[model samples]
Target: MNSKKLKILLSLFTLNSLSLYLYFSSHPDHRRLPSRSYSVSEYSPPHHPLSVKPWPILPSYLPWSQNSEPPFRSCEAYFGNGFTRRVDPLKPNAESHRKISPSAGGGGWFRCFYSETLRSSICEGGRIRMVPERIEMSRGGEKLESVIGREEDDELPNFRDGAFEIEVGDRSRVGKKLVDEEFLDKYLEEGTIDRHTMRGLIGSIRSVDATEFVCSEWIEEPTLLVTRFEYANLFHTVTDWYSTYVASRVTGLPIRPHVVFVDGHCQTPLEETWTALFSSLTYAKNFSSPVCFRHAILVPLGYETPLFKGLSETIDCYGASAQELWQKPDNKKTARLSEFGEMIRAAFGFPVDRHHIPKPASGHNILFVRREDYLAHPRHGGKVQTRLSNEPEVFDSIKSWASNHPNCKLNVVNGLFAHMPMKEQIRAIQDAAVIVGAHGAGLTHIVSATPKTVILEIISIEYRRPHFELIARWKGLEYHAIHLRGSYADPPVVIDKLSAILRNLGC
Candidate 1:
């Protein structure tokens, strides 16, 4: 009786336990419990400030403005001379924010602002200058407010340390050796310059990041970095100068640069005059008065060479010769080129007035740039084998065509202007409506020409280069090209084509 009773009770208990387990596994409410618990963690939004102070609208000259949707708020957050990493509220998670170097190379005033709706932030990428007893920001010739009350931890390194500056020797004959001897001799004597040698020259001294120049020299003010690398040849000097502009674009900082020179003749009359017009030329060895920069940027050389890995095109470019560095081309982008021109006109001790160009009394000046007596290469002088020939006929035909139009003003400017002061050169080209010239470095003066000007480039078929063509396109000028055939000294230009070009320009 005891065995039968125990077996029946055990079997009944086991059956009930199995039935309960099966019911819970298939039940809809019981199945959803696990997923609901997981969703609580995944779908919960991170906490962020619902409201922010209205973002102050920056002036146009200040580089940026509040162009997004409303609820835009920005505040000035202070950082130590060398601060990196995102500020508070910009990104709730400190790790997710971008690593920013406020004192790019040295220490100065820095600002960070954000748009809550856009979930993005913008900061001063360059050095900011402060007035005595006042917190002010100086940029693009305008003064801005440096509001306080929001300060972040200064996570920057000791900017005064020599870690940023790269020195070879006191005089560092690298510049001289490259420009005067090795660069020229190797290219001229050897007929073909080595690529590694050229790349070494670019990376050796001249190519440094803008942040590398930030130091205690400037103390606590903003600095503009001016580089004096290759300023002899007009093409090399101007193209090199494009790096400074590119640095500013990359860092959002003003370019207050210190010019380092290897050659006594580092800059030509035009180069010197061009720089003097906006920023002063200075030597890096002037330690007693070392150029101080709060916000500094280095324009990496963008070339078709290996020393700089980026391509010449603006799009599809990145990486640098050095780590943590960015690279961009010195070629023309319309807005940047126009800004460069305006800054140049302002620097030359002239009023920044665009109206200085006199209205056309009759018609625009058809300034014909003749290369009759001009020579680029040292061996170019005694050559009957030059690329441009029949210069006299080209000038004569343009003059003859101009006579037919009452508004057409014809001026034949020979190479004599090369000897003129840079100011005179700027003045001569500044008022020109139509710049007609042979393909040469003299055409670089088009940087001073007003917008909507016409540029007619007479290129020799033997030596065809798109340098000036790119310049004209960037400067927003009307460009027309005429090819020549025959000898360099007397290549023939199509007179009828020249006449048609003049007619289209309302000559």
Candidate 2:
């Protein structure tokens, strides 16, 4: 029966082929028509299985299933200390991001799916634990030139070692400085880098890449990086410190700049916590993005500074200092961190979340704050006092030359100090030949000063904040002591100390 059916089909095919060939031959004039070769196209289409599998539609009855998509997103559930559902990163699912365990410095169970420009944070799961019981002790006896070589430029003697200057096994073993200080639980003590130190360090660097490239394996440096960056944090945000830097290209300053907080600060916008978070002194290190810019960091924790240099922006008027009169006493009372972040953003003309990493340029000055410095100068003394009261006296205690020294020149233009950008304030302070200040937030700005900058650390003759002296020495600054008779609130804090320090610098 099969052979008979095959013979019938063959007979039919033969008749059809003969008829078609005859018809084509009869129409030979069609050769003038374009060659009718079928233009072949190849593609992949969804494959349907010949057989069906059992359906678990019963899951639809789940209480959470009411809003589940028809074709639910695929998640790979990998259970470890906790369940980590690896959502497809390409789809922007919350589960696809990197998981940051409290062990790795997360507040609780927060996960940052991507490793972006992590310029700010030092250690994650930041608890104010006793300082590390052990650290590769600094071979303090070895001079800077002896350890890393004195010649920082090209043509160094140890060029053959490798691109990195640190010699093999050079991290001479040293005992970690045991942490002896204690603080209340209210301070976000878990994270590293005291806010005071960070302010100085962050203020020291003059520019943050509005954009930066995200990197995971570039472990020798920031979690993210871009050429010529300043004041970048984990949120992939930047602060252009030099007034000339942003305006060197664009004519004016920006009203809104892209930003992110890399430190272990809680990520919350002022709008989200208008009543609760802001009302209470939660922590100085919190972060948030309101408007003008959304974050590409995708999540709050994923946001970092020094973003990839794939984008660009006109620095324009955004580089100028804010004219909202924040230095005034009443203004200081309203100076919220979110607002501070907002003021600089607008001054630099960048969306709080919009960053374009710029292509690197030559002859750029680079400023780096050692990890040692970052851990010392916290804004709050592990107390809820990080938020300072804006008062004339508070400003008076700092006794900064910002108002007195209208025209100072460190590099190029004169009168630079008078019109510097928010980021430039630290740089200008650093450029000063002599530095002076009582024990307060303004001292944090001193970390940016050029080496050889003399420091006049004013503290009580009876009481002392030892970190200042240690930091001054570690940073290679010329250290001087000013022993005051009382707390920093006293008049001698400024009147007696400021003038002497300034005269020494030839101010």
Candidate 3:
């Protein structure tokens, strides 16, 4: 099996066990264990928890943007960075791993950018600036709508709170109007292409800090916030933490990050989780009313952050009871890829959701045949030793099934393509009307299928799997199983039974 996929499984298992570790850290289960190698890196808890006080100063307040006609500062306020990698840092001199979208005629305008490379934001903001447009309220609305990136918009993560605010002031506070009509044609308004533009417009940038109040300045009073002392170790937020979001219109807190993932309340600093969080923010669905900032905070027991009240989708998964959290039943585990898939989905912005089809594309019917789908060979990665199609009956059966129906088309995409780039594979599968595959990694692609796609999962009797069935159910696709006797060497047959199953099922 691919180590990366296995790593995801290990991550889930580790999360399930974290509640136990919380217990182990306390008096009832006090015990010390030697350190071991971790997937990312070896880590050992500090002899004492490290202090997180004043956030570190960002590299620079502002920098010169490339090809700029005027001076501007970066709006990132210092988050996002590159993780350790092998790629040459300076290669393709201007190569940026993120896709950014900019707002026009800026005055408190939101500029959007989506990071394409994980952890590649280390040099962020350095290269881009979130300057506002010189706006004169082109159209009137009760609230301002700003898109931070190129795709789908949603309620800020845990943004289960707040109201929109309107700002009407001298548009001059934003940068130059650069009203050249030709500039607008440069950036794309649709599908993300490789085309690159150095524009930095995201959440409305504060022209002058503490000077305005409408998503621009802090209210005179501190926003009332709910917080906790305990939280997940990974989410540990700073003590005396101070932050702010746009003021709430309902209860009227300065700003609240609408909450999501409220499950890990042990504060992971907002800056530390910004990339992952922002990706989710772009993926969040329609908000109710009062869409606003959503943030998460974490803290240690008996410690408190400053009256720092920042709006966030503050997930407070702290102090969860161990019994309710750590006691997980085996086999109940969701797909190992599900979490990463969530991140990717969020990263994908709304393109996937907006493309949701009530039915699979009707253009072509494709069945991907694989040798190990029926069973995961005990070997590592379940390497298939033979051609599944050449086996007397697998292809013949598929051929016969195709011959029986004129409307139903059948095409073959190899199993080798299963682990290929998902973007390309998914694009191909998107065009396939019917997808037939075995219970293997390729089946994971079902997550990208068009609705109404028929999926036939071939299973091994000795190792019947409910995993594919599980995904099919969640994906809302038509799915059924073909059980085969692993020990029976009937030339790996696919008989008329396959036809009966497909013809009877709705796709």
> In terms of TM-score, which candidate is strongest?
1
Clashes (backbone N, CA, C under 3 Å), per candidate, total: 29, 71, 63
- Candidate 1 worst ten-residue window by lDDT: 74-83
| Total colliding residue pairs, candidate 3 | 63
TM-score of each: 0.50, 0.25, 0.31
Candidate 2 structure quality by residue, lDDT tens digits, 1-507: 599657645654554455445533322211122122212121112112122111111100111101212121111000000011222211121221232211111111111121112212211110111111111112121222333322211111111111111101111211211111231111112233222222222112111111111111111100111111111221122222221111111111111112222222222122121111111111112211111111111111111211121123111111111123223212111112222333233332333321222322321121211111121111212222222222234344343433444333222112122133434554445334555444443444443344345666556545465544543543345677666455433544444554554445444
lDDT for 452 in candidate 2 is 46
List per-prediction Cα lDDT, in the order shown. 0.39, 0.25, 0.29
lDDT, residue 347, candidate 1: 51
Give me the overall lDDT of model 1. Answer: 0.39
Measure candidate 1: CA RMSD.
24.9
User: On residues 202-317, what C-alpha lDDT tens digit does candidate 1 reach at each position?
Assistant: 22222123333323333322223333323435656565554444333323322233333211122235555645632344433333322333333333232311111111332221
Question: Which candidate wins on lDDT?
Answer: 1
Count steric clashes of candidate 2.
Answer: 71
Model 3: weakest 10-residue lDDT segment is 119-128
Candidate 3 matches the true fold with a TM-score of 0.31
